[model samples]
Target: MKIFNTPSNSSTISGFLLLGFPCSRKGQILLFVLFSAVYLLTLMGNGSIICAVRWDQRLHTPMYILLANFSFLEIWYVTSTVPNMLANFLSDNKFISFSGCFLQFYFFFSLGCTECFFLAVMAFDRYLAICRPLRYPTIMTRCLCTNLVINCWVTGFLWFLIPIIITSQMTFCGSKIIDHFLCDPGPLLALTCKKSPVTELAFSTLTLVPIMILFLFIMGSYALVLRAVLRVPSAAGRRKAFSTCGSHLAVVSLFYGSVLVMYASPASEHKAAMQKIVTLFYSVVTPLLNPVIYSLRNKDMKKAMQKILGM
Candidate 1:
């Protein structure tokens, strides 16, 4: 019997070489500096939000609590890729160990999945606060909010565990060179000795299905929210409602828009450079921009951040 359990000819492959960005020595140094600055800024921005949420008594609410948690998630989310990417930029070999690559693949995707669930939960929170304000306090109690947060983390981490394990066990042969910065499923699968169409389909389904469902849920919530806002007698009240939701919608747009494009079709269909840009956008740039979007659009958060900064 042909055994799928054992690798055919890839046993010697100990690691995968991540090609990172195609740039000159000078360009690499410049990119290293640029991404380093961005990484530091992203950490500080998200950290400040968490601090602002924790220290500000006036900001102690479900929304802010969710925001704080999301910020915390973003911190680790970016960490899962940026530091390694920075290291790759400086290193000549640009080699990541076999296990290390898959571990990164797992954590990066798991964290991203968590972020998706968090976004959907945040949207739900907004729906409750805006559509059912009277019962919001009673329904979305501290206990429930905490449970929801826990559920997001648990569900997200668990969601991709089986798929990652299955993918890791497959036989990877020939070239261990991944053309992208990170250990993505597409590049890894492309290196496998045997083509597993079922595995590819599972990965695609896992990546796209949850995102679509969450996006649709967010849209449905906003539709009802829009309906309610228009019925408000006062323009000021409507403006307040829109202002509150605008930040989330902006974040949602930035995240979902890029991810949808990245995963809409097979990654092989996309140019390597384009893949890198899209992945970098959603993974690195989005996290950096999230805190700014929230802090600028949210007056309460702005004030809280200002207080923390002694402004």
Candidate 2:
């Protein structure tokens, strides 16, 4: 409730103090080691998926093409925050400059938004392949897929343009101390001197509406796919359909499960430590798991990975 007399522009505020994970020096070092290992694995795992898709001519279809781009997005998405967090672990002061913080904030949200668009597009690809098998080649052409990919990236970055600008212009209160490792929106908003419900709603709408709409669209796409698959008389055909959709469903669960929990409700009710843990679940754990989920359940993916690894 106490308002610090800081300027309304965030740039005027001195560097923010991020009170990252409360732990002893030994514990910090341990976490640093653990996070570092996870970060490296995430990069390598997703990187391998992209490489496999690119090098193997068999994996150049729209499905694998989308997966390759999605994997690349995951790499940068995780990098947008984790590296800075790793540095925070070793730094004594834990200070992040205003520009640096906002830049991370911008890229993190943009990439996440892009991922949502990509997932929905991926689902549509599956639907087209399953529901309209004969015309799929004509409908989902290479040019169309290329356009969809570029649209996802462009629209995501542009989606929050006004809302983020509005958020950044808000004044900060007495505390510039963020308890979490990243420049998460909840924590950033909480730091504002006065809460603007209208701006908050606009921001929340910008964040949640796309997620909800895309989620429903994906569900609908799957529903249609499932219905059509059931109509197929051959057991082998049914199994193949299920196998392809299953991997996507699993990846979706891992992502949206954590996201809806953390962001779909009031931010103030969740404790800072809980926020950190939940964010870490999606941000670090899921990226590492996605490549495994996509590859292990898929035949082409497995072959591609084997070829890439020369195994």
- Model 2, stretches more than 4 Å misplaced? 1-12
Candidate 2 lDDT tens digits, 1-311 = 22235655543456578788979999999989999999999999999999999999998899999999999999999999899889888889898877777788889888888988999999999999999999999999999999999999999999867667877777775677888898888889988867789888888888898889988998999999999999999999999999999999998888888988988898888999899999998888999999999999999999989888889
Error of 1 at 147 (Å): 0.3
Superposed Cα deviation of residue 309, candidate 2 (Å): 1.2
Q: How accurate is candidate 2 locally (lDDT)?
A: 0.89
Clashes of each: 0, 0
> What's the lDDT for residue 87 in model 2?
89
Weakest lDDT window of 10 consecutive positions for candidate 2: 1-10
lDDT of 1 at 201: 90
Clashing pairs in 2: none
lDDT of 1 by residue, 11-81 (tens): 55778999999799999999999999999999999999999999999888999999999999999999999
